[model samples]
Target chain A: MASKKNLVPRRDFIKTSALGLSALSIGLPLNSALATSCGSSGKDKLGIALVGLGNYSKGQLAPSLLETEHCYLSAIVTGTKEKEKEWAKKYNIPKGNIYNYENFDDIASNKDIDIVYIVLPNSMHAEFTIRAAKAGKHVICEKPMAVSVAECKAMIKACDDNNVKLSIGYRLQFDPYHKRIINLSKENTLGSINYVNADFAFTIGDPTQWRLKKDLAGGGALMDVGVYCIQACRYSFGQEPIALRAQAFNSGNEKFKEVNETITWQMEFPDGKISNSTTSYAMSVNSLFVSAQKGKAQLMPSYGYGGIKGFIKDEILEFPKFNQQQAQMDAFALNVKNNTDSIVPGEEGLKDMKVIEAIFKSLEQNGARILI
Target chain B: MASKKNLVPRRDFIKTSALGLSALSIGLPLNSALATSCGSSGKDKLGIALVGLGNYSKGQLAPSLLETEHCYLSAIVTGTKEKEKEWAKKYNIPKGNIYNYENFDDIASNKDIDIVYIVLPNSMHAEFTIRAAKAGKHVICEKPMAVSVAECKAMIKACDDNNVKLSIGYRLQFDPYHKRIINLSKENTLGSINYVNADFAFTIGDPTQWRLKKDLAGGGALMDVGVYCIQACRYSFGQEPIALRAQAFNSGNEKFKEVNETITWQMEFPDGKISNSTTSYAMSVNSLFVSAQKGKAQLMPSYGYGGIKGFIKDEILEFPKFNQQQAQMDAFALNVKNNTDSIVPGEEGLKDMKVIEAIFKSLEQNGARILI
Candidate 1:
C-alpha cells in the first residue's frame, strides 16, 4: 500500500501558483483550483526522476524534460549501477537521488522528487508504474500502457488503490496544434468528418533494439507509432470506432518474427464515416489527415518529437516549437495536484489497446470486418 | 481516317484584346496562335461536339471551351435530349448539330464537327474515344484513361491508326502549381525524395452514381479519386513506383458494390524510400504531400479546380486561380499543331492505370505486396 505523504500534493501545488489565487477568488474548491491552475500556468519547475534509461528516455524524454519549465531532472534509476553513475555525473544530478533497480521501490523515500516518469521497455512499464504508485508517487508511463489490456487494467487498479494519479504518455493529446485541430473538428469547421487518412512509418536501421523484440516492446510499429494514428482518429472525430478491419504483412525475417513491420487498417464510426490508416517500420513517415465536408486538418510530421505543424484548409494555424514529452509531464503533474482526470487517462489508453487488439485479430482473419 | 481538313482549326475565333497580346508575350502561348499561325489557318470555325454532358463536362469542360480561342460548340450527343437543347440554346448552337445515341455514328459524314470530347462513364470512355477516332475526328478523353489496362492500350491504338492525337485530360499536369512542384522536386529543392504522403478523397452522398458502379467506374474511390494521388506520387518523385501494397474497405451498403469507399496504400521507390498514401470517398478531399531530407512540398486540396496552394518548408510558393481544365485544353492544342508531346499524354495515363490495376489486385489478395 502507498502512503498519502509520498503522493503528489495536488492542493498544495495549486496554492503555490497564480492559478490558485484566481481559483480562490472564484470561490472554487481546492481541487478545481489546482485543475484550473494546471491549465493556466505556463511552466513551473517540478523535480522529476526518470526510471529505465532506454533509448527513447535518453534521446527524447531527457531532452524534452530539459525544455519543460514545470519539470527538471532530479534523479535517475537504472538496473546497472555503472549507467546510473555515468548519467548522474553527465547531468550533474545529486548522488543522494541515484538508485539501482534493486532499491527502486525506495525512491518514494526521497523528498525532492515530485514525479516519476517511466520510459522503460514496454513490459516493464506496468511493473515499475505499479511499484511507483505503491511508493506514493504520481506516475507517467509511456504508450501501449502495458503489454496486454489485462496488465493495463491491473496497473490502473494499483495506482487507484494507492491514491496516486496515473497518466499514460499520449503526448499528442497535449500538443497545442493537435489540440487546436481537435477543437476545430468539434466546432464543425470542416463540417462533419466523413473520412480520415492517417499513417506513421519509418525505416528502422537497428534490429537488435528492444523495439524489435516483442517481449520488451510488446509489438512493432503498430504498437510503437500506429497508436498515435489511432488516437488521432478518435480525437479528430470525437468518438470510438464502432467496427474495424485490418491487414498486416511480414517479410519473413527473424528481426520482426514476433511483431509486424507493416499494418493497414480501417475503422467505421457510427456516422458512416470510415478511417483508413497505415503504419510501418519499413516505410516512410507522414502526418495523419482528417477530411470533413467543409475542409481538412493535418499535422505535418505528426508523430515526431520535432517539427510538427498543423494545417487547416491549406492554411497553417499552429506552428510552435513544442516538446511533447515535457508537456505530457507537466499535464500529469497538474492532474495529480488538482485531482483531475488525465487528458489521456488510463481508460483512454485501455480503449486504444482494445482497438489495437481488434486490429490484430482482423488481420489474422484476412481482414474480415470485426465489430468493436 | 480523319483528314486534317475535317478538323476545325481552333485559332480563327481569337477575340484578343491588348491585354491578351501582353499575356501571350509573357511566354504563355495562346492556343489560337498554334492553330492559325503554325499551319494553314482555316476560314470556317471548326465544328466541335460533346459526347457526354454529365456533371464534369457541364461544370468544367463546356465552360472552358466557351472561353477557348478556336473551339466551337457545333454538336451535342447526349442520352438526354432536354439537356442537349438547354445547352444548345445557352451557347447559341445550331439545332442541326444535335444527335442522340442512335444517330451519333452518322456524324462521321457531317462536315460540321472536327473533334469530339468524351466525358462519359469510365467503362464507356474507351468505346466512345475509339468510335470518335474511327469517325474521322480527334479525341479528348477524361482520365483513368479507361476501365482497364487493355482498354487504355486499345484507345491508344485506335487514335494512332486514325492519325489523330489521343489526349487524356489530366488537368493537374497543366496546372502551374503542380508543374512547379514537380520541377522543384526534380531540381532537388527538397533534396532527393525520401518520402511521400498523397491523398484524395471526398464524401459521396449518392450511392447509385456512376462512381459507385464498379463496372462503370472501374474500382471505387481509388479509380475516381485515388488516381490523382497515384499520379501526384509519380510526378513528385519523378519516377514510377517499383512496388506497392494496398488495403481497401467497403463501409457502405455491401449490396451496393461498384467502388470502394476507402483505400489505404503504400508505394516503394527504388531508392529504398517508400510512400504511404490513402484515398477515400467517405472523407473530405485532401492534397498531395512530399517530404525529403531537406524539407517538404505540400499542396492543400491538391486536386481542386481552383484556389490551389503549394508550400515548401512552411513558405507559400505558389497560389494560382487559373482554370486547370482550360490550361490543359490549350496545351493539347499547342501539342497538336507543334508536333510536341503532351505533359500528360497517353503514356502517362497508361502508367497510372497500370498502378491502379496492381492496387486492385493487391486489395483482393488482402493487401498482398505487389511489384509494379
Candidate 2:
C-alpha cells in the first residue's frame, strides 16, 4: 500500500515509543541470525498491547516481549478480568494500560500503546485488527490473516486508512533455516527447483477445540498450521502457484465430524514446478523437501514452533535456534516506527489467503485442477 | 494365486537346502550378518543365476549373493559379452554357467542353476520371468511386476504352471525398520492409524535413461520408487486402500516430455484412515510418517536401498543397518526350499499393480477419486 502522507507524525510515534517498558523481543546490535538492535537512547521504544491472552500470548509472545529492543508489552486486552489483574501485577503494567474487550476501542486516546498485536482465534482477526487500527495503533495479526479474503482486505483497508502499518505474525519468515532455504532458491544454488514436498500434521488432543469449528477457524488444518506449508512453497520459489488440485478426507472417526481430518493438495507454478503438500489434524508429520535440477535439500520436522533443523543433501544448514518471535516482533516495531511496510505485511498474509481459497475451492470441485 | 501341485519331492527340497552354498541370503542359525558357506559333500545347494547386470544387480545383489547361505551365484545371463567376461572372472563362475539371453532357455538342462533373478527393465520383467519359470527355475522379478496387469498375471500363471515359485524383489519388506513400523500398526501400538504421509522423489540424473522412457519404465517415478510409498502405507495399515484420488503434474522441463515429473495421490481405507503420498522424478525426497490415535511414528530417508532410520514419537527405533537384499534373497530361498510362498509373492506385486492402475485412472479423470 502507498504510504499515507502527513498523517501519524514521527514525533507522535516516538512519544508512544517512550512509553514502552518491557517486551517479548530482545534486539541487541546485530545477532548472527538476524539484524537486531537495542533502540538508541534518543528514541523511545514502542509499546505493544496483545489483544488475546491465549496460549500463544502466554507461552511465546509475552516472554519474548521482554527481549525486544524496540517494543514492549505495555498493555493487554482480554475478556478475563482475573487474567487482566494477574498480568498487570506480573508484567508490572500500570492499571491505566489494562483494558477488557469492551473497552478496547477506548485505547485510541491512550498514547502508551502504539501497536495492537491481535492473537485471537481466526474468525476474530478482522474485527480486532480493524478496531486496533481505528484506535490509532499499528496492527500485527496472527496468520491465516483472517477467515476469508474479504476480511483480509478489510483489515488492510482499516490499517491503511488509519495510516498505521499492518503486519502479520509470520515468524518463520524471520527464521534462519527458512531464510537460508529461500536464499538458496533466490541464488539458484540448486538450479531451477523441480519439486517441493511439505507436510505439517499433528494429532489434535481435543477435537472440541475452537479450531475444529468452521466458523471459528475458517477451515481445518489448512487454516491453522498448514499455512507454513504454503509459506514454504511461496518463499522457496518467490512465485505464486498458477494452478492447483486438492482433496480433503475425513478420518471417519467421530472426532472429525465438524471438519476435515486430512487435506492433501498439489500446486503447479507457471514454470511447471510442483508443490505437493498434506495437512492433517489426525497425524503427526513435519517436513519440507525441495528437488532442483542440480541437487536436493530436505528438512524433516521442517515447520516447528522451535528447533527446526535441515540439510542440503548430506550437509546441514547449521545455526543455533534463536528466539523467532522476538525477531518478528522487533522487526514489526521498527517497520512501524519508520512508517514503512513490514516484510510480513498484511499483503503477504493476503496472498496466502488467496491460496487457501483456491485450495478449498479445488477440494469442493472434487480435486479438479483449479486455476489461480 | 493358488498353490501349484507338487513337482519336486519334499526330500529333494531339503537336499537342495542342506547343500546350501555361499548364498545371496542366509536364514540359517542367523549369523552376525552373513554366514556364507560353500556346500559340503552331504548337501546339494540351490544354485541361482542373475539375468541382468544393471546398477541394482552390480551394487546390491551381486555382493549380497556372495553372502547368501541357501543359494549361490552359479550362473549368469547377460546379452552383453563384456559384462559376461568381467562378471565370470570377478566371481569365479564356470564357463558352462555363462549364457547369453539367446541361450538363457538352454539353462533348463544345465542342472547347475535353480533360480533366475530378473533385474531387467520394466517391459522385460514378464518375458524373462516367464522364460525362467518355463526353464524350471524359481524367479525373482524386480518391481513394478510388469508394464501392465495382464503381463503380471501372465508371469504369475507361467510360474504356477511350471510349479516354480515367483517372488517380486521388494527389498524393504525385509528391512527391519519398516518391519517394525508395520508391526506397530499390526499390534495397534499407536492405536488405529488416522493418517500417513509417504513420499519418495529423486532427481533423474540422466534424462535419456530407461527410467524416463515411457515404454521402458512403464511410467515414471510412481512406477519406479513411488511403489515404496505405496508399500509403506499398505504395510503400515495392513489394509488395501478402498478408494483413491490422484493428480499428475509435469515438471515443465523439456526432459520430462515423455512422462510425468510428479504424481501425488491420497488413498482412503475402509476405516477412514488416509494415506497421502507423493512420488516425483523431478525432485528428491524420502520420508514416511504414520499417526494413530495414541501417538505417531516417523522414518526419514525411509525407503532406501539401505540406510534407514526412524522413531516412534520421542523414542528412536535403533538397529544397525544390514544388507536388505541379502535378507530378502535368503528369505526367498528359504521359502522356496520350504515349498511355501515368498513373503513378497507374485500376488503381493499384483495387488500394488491394481493400486497403480487406479491411481492413473484417477489422474486421467481429472483427479476424480476411483474406488479400489
Candidate 3:
C-alpha cells in the first residue's frame, strides 16, 4: 500500500502564493471588483478561447460562457469551418478570432485571447494544451486529464516550463452538495469512512460515438462516467487508493472491440476502507454512496449534467443550484488572474489516471488484485 | 460453472402425495390447495414449540406470534428452567408443554406440538432442527441455515428421512417490496438485468456479543447481514452465480479471529450480469441496487428488520408491513397443511452456503477469481 508520505508534494511556489493570496482575495466583496475590471470601456473580462469545438464544447461549455461575467468567448480554433462559422454567428464572435486547425499556432498573435480551453478528443489534449501554454495562455483541459500517466506528466511539464497555470475540469470538486459530503467526511461527522458503494452507467445505443473509438476517447465508460466515481471516492474519503481489483465485460460485438460495455472494480485504501464501484454503458445509472461508521451519504445521479441531489441517512440535503462547469471555469479564471493553484490540479488527475490504469490491468489479468 | 442442465431434478416422491400428506398432517397447506385456500383456514392453527428461549426468540418471534392468527406458541424448550417458566406464563403456554433440552424429544409424545422453530447459535442449528424432524415435527430454522455445507446437507437429509417439511427463514422472499423488485426484474420492467450493487454493514461496537464469536456466529458480517444481500442478488436476477472473487480485511482486531470484519465480493451470473456486493461490521448499513437497460430499482435499507421500501426511477413503492419471522412461520404452517415444497427450502440455503464457502476460499487466496 502506498503511504501518505509517498504522495507527490504540491508545487512549493504555488502553495505559498495560494495561502498568501487567499487571505487578500477573501476581503474583496463579490461583484465590486467586477465593475472596476470589466466595464464597457476597459479590457477587464478575461478573453477566453476554445480549441477543438466538439460536442462537449458546444453542448456544455460555450453556452456556459454566455452567462459568465468574468470571462467571454474571444476566439475559436476548430478543424471544421462550418462549425466555426455557425458558433461565431450564434455568439456574435468577431471573424478575426476564428482560426482553423492548420493556423491554430498563429493564435499566439491574437491579443484578445488570454485563456485557451482544450476540449478536443482525448488523444489531442496534451498537444493542444502544451501549444496553448507556449502561446502565453492559461489552459483548462477536460478530464481523464490525458490518455496515460506519461501524457499527463508531459502535459504538466509543458505547462510548468511555460509558466502557465494548468487545471483539469473535475467540476464536482466545486459542486456544493458534493463539497458538503466531503467536508462532512473530513470532519469525521460520519466517523471514519469504512466503505464506499458507487456506480455510473447508461445504455449507449450509438456505437459510432467518439467514446467507442479508443484513439479518441481513451477508453469506455471508465473514462467517461467511471472517472467521476473514482474522483468521488478519492475526494469523499480524502485519500488515495493503494490497491485495486477489477473485472470487465466486453459486448463481444465487433463494433465494441475498442471499448468495454461494462466494468466492475474495488479499490482498497490504507485504512482498510474499500470503495466498491462499477460502470457500464449497457446498464442504468446509479447513486454514489459513502458508508461510514456513523451513517452513509449518497448522491443519486452523482455525475450527471443536471440536478444532482445528495442524501444522508435517507434524507436529502438541500443546496443551491450549482452549474459545475461554470464553477470549474470560474476557478480556472481566478487561478489564472491571481496565480493560484487549482483544487483539482494536473497532479490530482495524474493520480486518478494511475489508478484507472491499474484497474484495467487487473481486469486484463482476469480480476487479479493489483497493488497501486 | 454449473450449467442449468446439471441441476438435479426435484425428487418426485418428495413432491408426491406421501410427502404432501405428511406436510398437511402437520398443518401446512398443500400446493394443490394453495390457490383456492389463499386466505382460508383449511387446517387448525399449528401449535409451535419454541426450542430456544433466547433474545431473538423472545424479542422478534414470540411477539410476532401474538398477532399471528394461524400459529400459536404452545410449548417451550429451554436449558434454563427459570426462562421456560417465565416465558410459558407470559404467553399462557401450558406447563405440560414445557421441556428442558434433555427432554425435548419427549414433545413428540404430545400431539399438540406440530412445529418446532429452532433459533439457536450456529453450532446448535443443525442438531436441534434434525432432532425436531426426527420427532416428527415440521422445522423452521433461522438463517445461516447451518454452519457448513455438510451441516446443511445433514439437516436436509434428516428432514427428508423423517418426512417432515423443512423451511429456512429467508423472510425477504415473503416481503412484498422485495418480491416486487424481483418480479419487476423478471418482467423486464427495467429491461435485461446487467448489474446488481448491494451492501449490508453496521458498526458493531459490542465485542462480547454472540455475533463476534466465530464458533457461535459461523462468520462475521458475511454470515450475518451478507446472507440477506446474497439472497437478494439471487432472487432479484432469478439465477445462481457461476463465478466469484472476494477480498476481506481482518482489521487487526483479535475479536474477529475466525471471520472477517469487512468483505467485498463480485459474482458473475449466467446472463452476463455481475453482482458487486460488500458486507462489513465496521461500516454503516446500505441499500441494494439492480441496474438494467431501462432503469434501476433499489431497496434502501434493503435487509433491515423493518418495512422494505423500493425505488424505481423517481418513484418509491411502499408495501404493508408483515412480520418477516411470523410470515415465514405462517408460510411454513401453510406448506405443512398443503403438503408443498418450501419457497426457501433447506436446499436453497445450502446453495447460498456453497457460494459463501467459495467467497471465503477466494478471499484466502488473496482475492483470486474462483468458479462456482
Candidate 4:
C-alpha cells in the first residue's frame, strides 16, 4: 500500500502537473492527512528512512534529524549489518524498521516510513531513489541527481508513476543567506549584475577514495563542489546561463588519472551578464563574488555546511545560525504532509546536470563555447 | 651632445646588446659620469624633465622626485602655457629649461636635463620617447610603453640609435611586496604553481575623458589597469603564457561605445599552469590570488599607487612603505650614471604588448584559444 493512502491530492496533483493517468492511480476515501501539531510523536511527525549510512548521513543528517520538528528518523537501510544494528539501537528504531539493501523493497509494507532519503554516491542515487519510489514512499535524492540526464529522467518518472513526491537535496535553498541573495536579485537591489565569480576547491586526500574514480563520481571536482558554484551563480542572478566555455587541467597526479583535477568555465547569460567558476581537487579556495552596476556582494567560505558569512556592499549579512540539513528535512516533511510540490524538485537537479554535460563537451573540444 | 658623452660604455653596450653599427657613434673624452656624492646639489643628481603634467605626474611623480636620492626635477614640458608657467614657478625651473611642445626638441642644447620622462597619453608615448632620444637624453616612458608592439619596438630602436638608456616606468617593479612575489616563484615555496587569478577594475567616470576613446586609449581597462593583472601573474609564475582565451563585454553604456567596458581572459603557461583575469571600466575589483601545490597566496587591493597588502598562506605580508616612483626613478638614474641596463627595459613592455595583441585576437574570434 502507498504510505500516502489518500488519493484525492494525488489525482489533483496529476492534473496540475500534466502527468497523464497511470496504473497506480486508485481511489481511496479522503481524510485529513495534515497534522494539527509539529511534535516528536510518531503520528504528528513524518518518518524518514535514510537509504545510506555514509559520512554525510552519520555526521550531519542523523544529528539534524533529531532536531527537525516535522521529521523523525524511524528506519534505515544499510548493506553493513553492523551499521544497521548500530543505527537501530542508537535511534531506538524497532527491529522491523531496519533492513539491509537486499530486503529494502519490502519497505512497501511498512506504513510508518513515509519518506526515503537517498544519500548514496553519485552513481547509486538513481537506483536507490527509484527503488524507494516503487515502494510507495516520497524520495529525496542527494545532489547531482544521477550520473546522466537519462537517469535523472527515469528517477523522476518512477516517483511520478508511484504517486509519490520527489525532491533533490538542496539544503542551501533553505539557508537564510541564500534566501537574501535571491531577494537581492528579485528586488534589483544591486542594479543589473554584470559579472559573477564563484569557486569551490579543496585538496582531496586518499587516492583510492570513490571520488577519485570517474565511474563512482561521474566527474571530478565539477560534479562534487562545482555544483555549489553553479547553484550560487544561478541563485545570485536569478537566471540561467545560455552559453559557456570551459577548460580542464590535471597536474599529472596518479590520484586523478581517472578524473579531472581542476576545471574552470565562463558562462554568459541573457543581456551579456557573465559568470566564471573554478572547481578543483588540487587547491583550497571558496568564494562567491558578484559585481553589479552600483555595488558588490561577496561570500567567502560560501559553500560550507555552516559558518557561511557574507557582505552586501558595506553591510554584513549575519543571520541566526541553524543546521541547514535540519531546515531542508523539515521543509521536505511539510511538503510531504501537505501533499504539496517541492521547491527543489527533480527538475532542479536535471538543469544542473545539463550544464555539467555542456561543460564536459566544451572541455573535450579544447575550451570551445558550448550552448546549453 | 648625447647626455652620456663618454663613448667606451656605449660601444661596449652595443657589442653586448648585438646592435649593428649605426651613424650616431661620435664620442667625447672619457670623464667620470658617476657622482661622488649623493645630495640635492645640481651635479650630484640626474635632472628629470617632466614631459606631461597630468594627474599622475602632478600628484605622485613630482612629489616623488623631491624625495629621490639620485634624481631631481629640473625642467617642465606642457602644451598648456598655464601649466608650464605654474610648474616652473612651483619647482623653481628656469625659463631656458622649460619648453612647450613646439620647442621641446630644443632641450638638446640644455645640458641641465639628463632624463626625459614621458608621462603623456597612450598614443603620445612613442612620439615623446623618440624625440627625447633624438634630443640626447635617457628616456623613461610610462607603462604600456606605447599603444602597440610596433611603437614599442620603434621607441627601443630610437633609444638604441641615440645610444641613450631606455626604461619603461614600471613603478611596481620597485615595490617590496612585488619583490616578495618574485621570490616566492624562485624559491618554489608554494611548490609547483597550478592556478592563478588576478583582476583590477574600477567604475570609470568622465565620459568625455581620453580613457573612454579608442584613439587615445587604444583599449579600455585592459590597456590601463588590466596590464597590472597580467604583470602580477607573470611575476608570480615567472613564466610567460604560451596560449590564451579572452572574452569582452559592453553594458551598452554610451561612454564605452568606442571601447570595451569589461574583459576576461584565461592563460596557460608551459606546464599548463592556468590563470584567469578580469578587467573592467564597469566594476571595482582588485586582487591577485595564486594556488599552488603546497599552499596559497593572496593580495586583495593588490594593484594601486599605495596601501597594497597581501598574505602568504596565513602569514601577513606587511613591510615598510616607501615611495615606489622615487625608487623607480632613482634606480633608473643609477643605471644611467653607472652605464648599466635597466631591469625594466623596453623589452619587458614589448612582451606585454605581444600578449595583449593575442588577447584581442582571441576576443575577436569569440574567446577562441590563441597561441601566444
Candidate 5:
C-alpha cells in the first residue's frame, strides 16, 4: 500500500509517455480528440508558422513538428534570405508560406498558417507575440515572454485584445519528471515542502554571442537559464514568494563585462518556507532539491534538454523521456485547435519575470530583502 | 591518462585507509610510526573518556568505539547520575574512571584516560575542553567548538598552555568521498573551481531539547549542521572567502522562536568564485556541488553518517567506506599516542565559527555583504 501510494504516478506516466514519446498520436493526435466538438474546424493538424529561423526554431521546433501529431510545420518568417531558402527546402514549406520579417503582417491572410510560434531573442518576444496576435494567429512565444514584467503584461494584453491565445515556451512544465514531482507535492507526499534548492548553470562561450549583450538578452544568466531554477521552486512549492533577497557575482572573464556570471537568490514564501537557488554562466551545475516535513525529493543533472533523473524519498524515479519541444508544441497546438489557452499562459511567465525583476533589484540594492 | 589523473587519489587512499579501517595497526597504528622518538611512550591502544552522554555520544560515539582499534571507551562523564551508572556498566568501565561534571577534574591522575572527547552542548564545549586540557588530557570537541569564537580561541590557548592536543570532531574530514573532493580541488582535477553549492538540513523535533535553546545550542542550524555546508564550500574551493552575505528564515513553530529555522548564505572567494549554501532545521536535505572550468563533482545526501554517494563528472564515484566515527576517533587517538596534534585543530573550529558569526551578522544587518 505504501509503495502503491508513492509509485503510482511515475508508473502510470511512464506507461503512457513511452507511447507519446514515439509519436504524439496515442489516439490519432490530440487535435482529433477535440475535432468532433468543433463545429467549423476541419483541419487535419493545426499548421504552425515559426516566426524566427534562429537556432531554437531551426533546431528544436522544426524537428519537433515531425513527431507532433497536433501540429505540422507549414510556414516560416525570417529576416535572412538564405535561412528562408534553406528552411523552405528542408521542411518542404511552400514558397507562398515563407514570409520575411518586413512581410510578416501578410501572414494574417495566409489560411495555411494557423499558429505563429514566436522563437525570437529575449527583447523581441513582446513585439513578435503582439504582432502575431494582431495578425489573427494564436501565439506561443519562447521563454521570458518579454525582457521585463511590463512587456510580459503588454504581450498578455495584446493577445487578449486580438482574441488569440498566448503561451510562454516553458517546456519543462510538460516534462514527465516535473509533472511527477508536482503530483508528489500535490499528494502531500513530502508533507508541505518548506525548503527548495534549485540551480542551473553552464559555462557560456563566445563573448560576441547576443545572449551576453544586455540589449538583446535583457539580463545575464537570469534571463537565460536561471528562469528554470525559479520555475522549479515555484512549481515545487505551488506558492509564489512573498519576499526575496539576492546576490550576484561575475567572473573576471572579459566575456561577462555586460552581465553577471553567476547569481544566487533566496525566496521567502508566505508560509515561511524559503527557496535557495543559483544560476551561473561560469560553471556547470543542474539540480533540484525539495524538503518538507515528511521526506525529501531530489535530482541532480535535472532540468536538462534530456536525461533528468531524481528520486522521491527512497524511490528512484526513472520517468520515460520524450521530445520536450514536441510535447510543448503539441500542447500549444491542442490549445490552438480547441480554441483554448495552454496551462502555462502569459501570466505564468509574468510571475517569473516579476520575481526576476525583484531579484535584480535586490542585487542592485546591496542584497536587501525585497518584497515581491 | 585523464582517468588516471582523476582516480589516483582514491586508489592511494583506499590502499592505505582500508588497512586503517579494520585495525588502527598496519603493524602498528599511525602514532606508533611516529612514537619511537618519545622516551618511555609505549601504549598499544589509547584510552578515551567521553564527556557528556548526549545523543551523539550515546548513539554514534559508543557504538563506533567498538570498531576502533587505536581507541577504546575507558570512562564517561555525565551530570546525569542514571546515565553515568548505565554507561559504566554497559562499557565495563571501572568505578574510579567514571565521574560526574563536578568531579571531572580529578581524572588528571588517571593515566588510563589519555584523550577526553567533549560531546557536550555548544555552550559547555569551552569549559570542558579547557578543563580537560588542564587535567593533562588531549581534547576532541564536537563541532561549533564553542558558543563564540572567543571561547574557541581560549580553548586553543588552554590546550597550548597545558601542552595537550585539541581536535575538532569533524568526522566528515576523514570521509573518503570528502577526501576525494578535496584532492580533486587541490590537484586542479576539475580545473580551478569557480562555483560550489553545499546545503545540510534536518527537521528538529522536541521543543524542550537543548538544541532549541539559544544558551545551550548557541545558534540554530548555522552553528549546528550549517557549519558542515560552510566547511564543504571552503574545502571544495581550496580558498577562503573574502566576503560573505546571508539571510535567515524561521519556521513558525514556537520551538524556533530563539533561533533560525533556515539560513542561506553566499561566500565570495578570492578568485571570483562563489559558494552558495543553506542549512535548515525546518526540513531535511543534504548535498554538495562544485563546478570548475573543466568539469564538476557533486554528492546529494552527502553529509550523512553513512551512504555518502556522489559523482565526479560523468563517472559515478564509489570510494571505500569505513565507520566515520571510528575513523575520526582512531585518528585522534593516533595523535595522542604520538604526542602530535590532529590536522583539524581548535583553530579550524575557530575559523568556522568566525564565518558563522559573520553570516549571522550579515543577517542581522539585513543581508549585508561582510568582509570575512
Candidate 6:
C-alpha cells in the first residue's frame, strides 16, 4: 500500500557518501544522514509532536530532540494529565500547542507541528499513525510498524492517500557501527554473507503489563524484541528471506501463559544464505553475528539505546557513540523538509511484518516451513 | 550393542566428587577422572599405539602420550613407511613394535601395545576399532564414532565380545572449564537452562581432500566440527534432546557438491528446553551460549585445541591450561589399570550418533520435525 516511488529510491540512500565510506575504516563520527542531499527544499527546521508520551518518548526521543538539528520538540499528545503538565513544564511548550488523545485529530489545523511521532504500545501504532496521516502530518511510527501485516498495510495506505511521508523509527539504521555493518554487507567486504546468528532478549518484568496480554501485544517476544533480530538480518544481507520456520517455547512460567516466553526461527534467503534468530523475554542476550566466505563480522550488544560495539575479523570497529534516536529524527525531518524518500519507509516495516506473520503461521502449524 | 551395565554406572561419574565440586568454584586444576576408583587390578602403566600418523596424532596425541602419567607411546601404525621410521626414532620405539596398517592385526602377539588409539578418517573408525578389539587391546576411537549407527553398534559389539574396554576420545570431559560448566548445569546454578545457542565453524581448505567426499567423511562439516557443538549442548544441559529439525544449505560452490557446506538444526528437550546449533565449512565461528532462568553462561572460541575461555554471570572462569589429550589418555589408562568403567565410553559416542542420524533424517525430509 506504500507509494512505490517512495520505496524505490531507498537503494540510493544505501549508496552513502564518501564520508560514510571513510567512517567505516576510520571509526569516526558518522553523520551520513545529515550529509545526504535530495536538493533541499526548505531552510527551517521541522517541529515534532510526540504521541502517547510513553517511556520510550520520555527516556529517548524527548532527550534526543534536544540535540537533533533538523527537528525540535514543539508539542505533545497524551491521555495522562500529570504527564501533560510535567512534560509541558519540562519542555517549555506553548499552551496552544498542547493536546490530549481525545483532541489529537485537531492537530491537522495546527501548522506548527509538521510531524507526529507515535511512541505507543504495539497494537496502538497503526491507529495513531493512520490518524496522524489523515491529519495531513508526516508520521514517524516506532518499530514493528504495527502488530499485523493488515495493520501495516492500512497504515501505509492512509499515509499514501493523505500524501504525507511515513518513516519507521529504526534508529540503528542511522547508527555509525551499524552503518559500517551495512556498508560491509553491501560491499561484500566479507565475501557474501553465508550465515547470520542474531539474538535480542531481556527479562521482562511486570506480568500485568500490556505486553503480556495477547490482545494488546498481538503476539509475544517475537512481536516485541524479535523484530530487531529480523531487522538486523535483513539489513546485514540487504535482502529479504524467501522462507521461514519458527518455534515458540513455553517454560511452564505462569507469567507467560498468555504469551510466548521464547521463540526461535530460521530464515532461508534466495542465495542459500541462512539466518537463525531468537527472541526471548526470559533471558538477557543481545548479539548479531555474521559469517561470510572470507571472514566474520559481529556486534555484541548490537541493538540497544547505546554502547553498540562491533568487530570484523581481528580489528575492532571504532566509531563515536551518538544519540541514535536523534540521528533517526533528524533524517526523518530532512526527508519531510526536502520531500525526499524515507530511508526506512512504511514498506520496510511491512516486509518485516510479513515475515512475522509467516513466523506465527509456522508456529501454528507446529514449526512447518512457510514460504514468505 | 554396548554393554548396558557399563553405561549404567556413568550416572555415578556424573555425580563427580567433592574435589571437583570445589574446583568449579575455585577454578583449580581438575583431576577428577584420575581420582575415580573401582579397585586396582594392575600396577604398571599401559602402552599405547596410535594408529594413523595424521595431523591429530602428529600434533596432539603423540606429544600428549609422552606426558601421560599412566600411558606411554610404545608403537605406531602407519600406512606410510617414512612416518613409521620417523616416529620410531622420535619416540624410541623398537622396530619390532612398529607395524603397517596391513599387518595391524599382528599386534595380537605384541605385549608392548596394551591399547590402540584409532585416529583415522571417518569411515575407517569402526574397522580399526573392531580389529584392535580382536587383537586383545583396549581401543580409543576419535569422535563421530562411526559413519552410521549400525557401524557404531557393530564396533561396540566387537569390543564387548572381545571383553576389552573401549573408550571414545572426547577430550573436553577432562578440561577444567568444561568441568565447571558441567557442575553449573547439574547443580542448576543458573536455574533450569532454557536455551542454548552454539556454533562451530571454520573455513576449510583443500577441495580434493577426503573430508569433502561423502563416502570418506560420511558428512562434511557436520561430521567434522559439528559433533563438538552437539557435545557441548548435551553436556551443558545434561540431557538428550527428544526431537529435532535440521536444515542443510549449499551455496553453489562445486567443492561441496558431494557434501554439505553448512547445516543448522534445532533441538527440543523433554523439559521444553531448546537448542539452536550451526556448523559450516565456509566461515569462522566458535561459540557456545546458554540462557537459563537466573543468568547466562557462555564461552567464546569454546572448542579447539586450546585457549578455551568461559564466563558465567559476572565472574570470569580462570584455570590453568593443561594438555587435554594427555588427560584423556591418562584417564583411559587409569580405567584400564584399575579395571573401572570408562567415563567417555563407546556408548557416549553412540548416543551422539543417534542425534546425528536424527538430524540427517530431518534434513532428508527437508527440515521436518524428526523425533529422536
Point to the candidate with the largest DockQ.
5
Give the Cα lDDT of each candidate. 0.74, 0.80, 0.77, 0.81, 0.82, 0.82
Candidate 3's docking class is: acceptable
- Residue pairs clashing, model 1: A10-A337, A44-A70, A46-A70, A195-B283, B8-B46, B10-B70, B214-B258, B220-B259, B220-B260
Interface DockQ of candidate 3: 0.45
Provide the clash count, candidate 5. 0
Return whichever of 2 and 3 wins on DockQ: 2
- Model 1, residue A367: C-alpha shift (Å): 4.5
Of the two candidates 2 and 4, the one with more favorable DockQ, higher being better, is 2
After the best TM-score superposition of candidate 4, give how far the Cα of residue A372 lies from its true spot, in angstroms. 3.1
**Cα deviation in Å at residue A22, candidate 3?**
34
The sequence of per-residue lDDT tens digits that candidate 2 reaches over residues B84-186 is 8899999999998999889888775555666789999998999999998876678899988987888989999998766678899999988988898889877
Per residue, candidate 4 scores C-alpha lDDT tens digits across A38-113 of 1112357888999889899999999999999998898998888889778987999999899888999977656567
Candidate 5's error at B344, in angstroms?
Answer: 1.4
TM-scores of all models? 0.79, 0.86, 0.87, 0.85, 0.88, 0.85
**Runs in model 3 lying further than 4 Å from the true structure:** A1-42, B1-43
Q: List the residue pairs that clash in candidate 5.
A: none
* Model 2 bad stretches (over 4 Å): A2-43, A187-191, A292-300, A312-321, B1-43, B81-83, B92-96, B187-189, B292-296, B315-321
| Model 5 lDDT tens row, A201-228 | 8888888998999999999999999999
Q: Which candidate tops lDDT?
A: 6
lDDT of 3 by residue, A207-321 (tens): 8878889999888889888888898888888888998888776646565688887888888887678888888887777578887767778888788767887787667888767
Supply candidate 5's per-residue lDDT for B258: 89
Ten-residue segment with the worst summed lDDT in candidate 5 chain B?
Answer: B32-41
Query: What's the candidate order when arranged by decreasing lDDT?
Result: 6, 5, 4, 2, 3, 1
